[model samples]
Target chain A: MHELPILRSIVGVALRHAVEAGASRVLAVDVKVGELRGLDAAWIQSYFDFVTEGTPAAGASLRLKESKALFRCRSCGATFPPGPHAGGDVACPHCSSKHVELASGNELLIESIDVV
Target chain B: MAEIRTIDIKEAVLSENAGLADRLRRRLMESGTFLLDVMSSPGAGKTTLLLETIHRLRERGIRTAVIEGDIESTVDAEKMAAAGVKAVQLRTGGACHLDAAMIEAALHELAPGDYDMIAIENVGNLVCPAEFDTGAHRRTMLLSVPEGHDKALKYPLMFTVVDCLVVSKTDYLPGSDFDLAALRAEARRLNPTLTVFEVSARTGDGMQGWCDWVADGIRGVADARDGALDC
Candidate 1:
């Protein structure tokens, strides 16, 4: 699955940053995933553990934070979060305009690495 | 417990791949080649549609090439080559999608500057390919009539990421409950700027519009190159 490859990248980034910071061990990797990505954190963590074995980040925990989808209206120029069923209908709440663009909510970032 | 020090590394997980894709896109623009990534579920007529589209493009004196991404077989590549265009096959073995690095390697093999357009038939999966950027100038995907219109709801990311949506297999829409209007509405909700075409590659219906859109892209790349040359 894609999670394995992405987790491998996470582990690689974490270890590299850890080593550069002169840390002896990595404690955890903090990542931010947007809602649109729909990635399961537990699934990614399992893959992270599998790939990080015998590395400095072998036992490091993965901390994933999900960000909600945000849309910016083209007409009213207002940004707002999607409704209850975000995927189904995403219109501007302020102007009720359908001409809205996805401003964020498709992010997959490694924010930081906790090392000691 | 040892003192924990936080190392701030605000980097994207696929930053390396994204960086390579950006560089490859710039290189393609400089070389006057329009790269198109074609994605869809298996058996959605990507090969059929591409063959026909390439034929039309060649008829208009636009050179075309193909890079096929399959999980294992080289069947599609062979077919493209038989149609009289240079085709390269990238067998991913077990991987589900093609990344930027693979495209970069394939470009070296393709010597892509010789062609006006290079289309990548990405591995037939809706999910993974949507996440990876393969340096394509435009990403178009097919949703065959048999796949149902609700597919846009099921695979939202795929719908959102694509530049164009081609509803293939219209020949099968006779008795099927595949609602084209509903699919368009749902897909546009996700991506309002998406260009959509309903075509049946089997009967050659709606193929001209699709080909024209692609030709426009190829001509745009050539125009950009000319503009750069003038500078």
Candidate 2:
């Protein structure tokens, strides 16, 4: 999976950062993945385990925080969470208009790393 | 005895990929190739449309090559090559999408200055591909008639980021229950300036328009680069 390479790169960067910060071993790595990002946490963890082998973060734990999809209605000017539906139809709770634009939930970030 | 300290290193997992994509953007601009990245779901007829596009561009004497991204196998690349164009396949092993670094690597393997246009056919995934920019000058997303018209709303990012929307499989419009008006409305709602095209790659209906757009984009790139050289 492309996630294997991408996760490898992420862990490499994190390990470098941890070592630079005077950490002997990274205890944990916290990452935030958005609901719409379509990243599988289990796969990412498995890839992390493979990539972190022989490094200071070899046995480090991975913590994933998934964010839910949220949207902002342009016509109603109201922000609401995305409903579990296939179509992009989101009735504005305020104006009942179905013209909503996504606001968040596409985030992919390494929130924090516990090292030393 | 060990000292345990919890450190906060808030960084993006895609930071490296983003950096590599930026590098690719610079390289593509410098190489004077107008890159068009296309994305859609499996069986959306992306390859079929691309074949027709390549044929039309070749007829007009435009040098073009394709970088095909797929989870596995080089079937699409082989198809492109058979259609008389340079095609490179970047296998993602099992990844759902392509990234900048992979494209950068593929670019190094190919002759960069040999083509005027480079079409990067991203993996058949609507969500992840939209998040990663692969140094394309323009992004295009295809939504076939059978795929339903609600795609724009369901995957807003993909629709919003694309400069053009190709409503493929127009021939099936009569038999299929696709709401053409709703699809156009939703796409325009997400991207007000998106150019929409309705075509059947099999019938060659809208190939000319797509070809003309590519020509214009290539000329624009050439003109800008020549002007910079003169300066």
Candidate 3:
């Protein structure tokens, strides 16, 4: 949970990777975060800002791609997006069955980092 | 002056974290310590299980240390220390998960040769921990009875990455109307390779299995390191 230390390390690794990949300055870093992972995008961006200091990634923009939690019904093989309604439980829109398996929305992938 | 040249460099943001994780893994292997990452939702008995595990391990003379990750506060670390274990708190300041670099820094604060095992208790979030690998030899996800059975399906990635699935708070089974079999079936379906254990840190139920697995993992790591050294 040490955001600064971890983010600093991540930035360091990312900058190193970028340099090794023939990059000078990173323009942007795109990351995907899933809802179930419970990550706050704003917080991550802030942390990125703090950690990227003095690194090749300094001043680089952090773009977060948020994925929603979706559930696939196991009984009817129906896939549906999670309801926007409040509360955590969501009933299947297709079969109206509670036997749903969650799909997507808990992703943390460094999709792409734009560099020059 | 009119012309300008620009270069396009597309890289992965997590490449750096992944690289560090790989290095940490190698170092852990070399040091004969098997790292275990524990993750779950907030108040899902992560600290309780950790406390009990640390106590049990100490009783058996297995030297262990903990890296407690939280968004803020050293309460968990304090609790672990009170139980007679060397524990350090790594405050995220609000980040959802623990990454390799934070763990690497924490390692510098501890005596490397003092402990035979290391447990990184990640921030109590299922999502980010799944994405960021902290170079642990094994990852374990805890699901408490109050959290419900749909967690595995809801948080598939967390379930998928973990080497073991611990269903904590077994003693509260009578109070909560949880479908244990269904949860197990769903978890197995998602991750067939996952080793499932039911534990109640409060009552000390089904903890032996958990401890045994830990011992076995440590022994396996030690044996591998010894074999490599012998070679």
TM-score of each: 0.94, 0.77, 0.70
Q: After superposition, how far is residue B162 of candidate 2 from its true place, in Å?
A: 3.6
- The better candidate by lDDT, 1 or 3, is 1
Better of 2 and 3 by TM-score: 2
Q: Cα RMSD (Å) per model?
A: 2.1, 4.4, 7.0
Q: Give candidate 2 regions above 4 Å deviation.
A: A41-54, A68-103, B1-8, B59-61, B70-75, B91-96, B150-161, B182-195
lDDT of 3 by residue, B1-231 (tens): 322223333443466777899999888888888888999999899999988998898788889999999999999999888888789899988789988999999999886566779999999987668878899989999999989988876777787678898999999899688988878776755554578899999999999999999888888888888998999
What value of lDDT does candidate 1 attain over all alpha carbons?
A: 0.89
Model 1 ranges off by over 4 Å: A83-91, A96-98
Query: What TM-score would candidate 2 get against the native?
Result: 0.77
What lDDT score goes with residue B142 in model 2?
91
Best by TM-score: 1
Share of reference contacts kept by candidate 3: 0.13
Across B1-231, the per-residue lDDT of candidate 2 in tens digits comes to 677777777777667777888777667667777788989999999999988888888878888889999989999999988888788899988888887888888887678778888999999988778878787878899999989988877787687668888999888888778998778776665554678888899998887887788788888777766777788
Q: Model 3 clash pairs?
A: A1-B92, A2-B91, A2-B92, A3-B92, A13-B16, A34-A105, A37-B127
**Cα lDDT for residue B33, candidate 1:** 98
Better of 1 and 3 by DockQ: 1
Worst 10 residues of 2 chain A by lDDT: A82-91
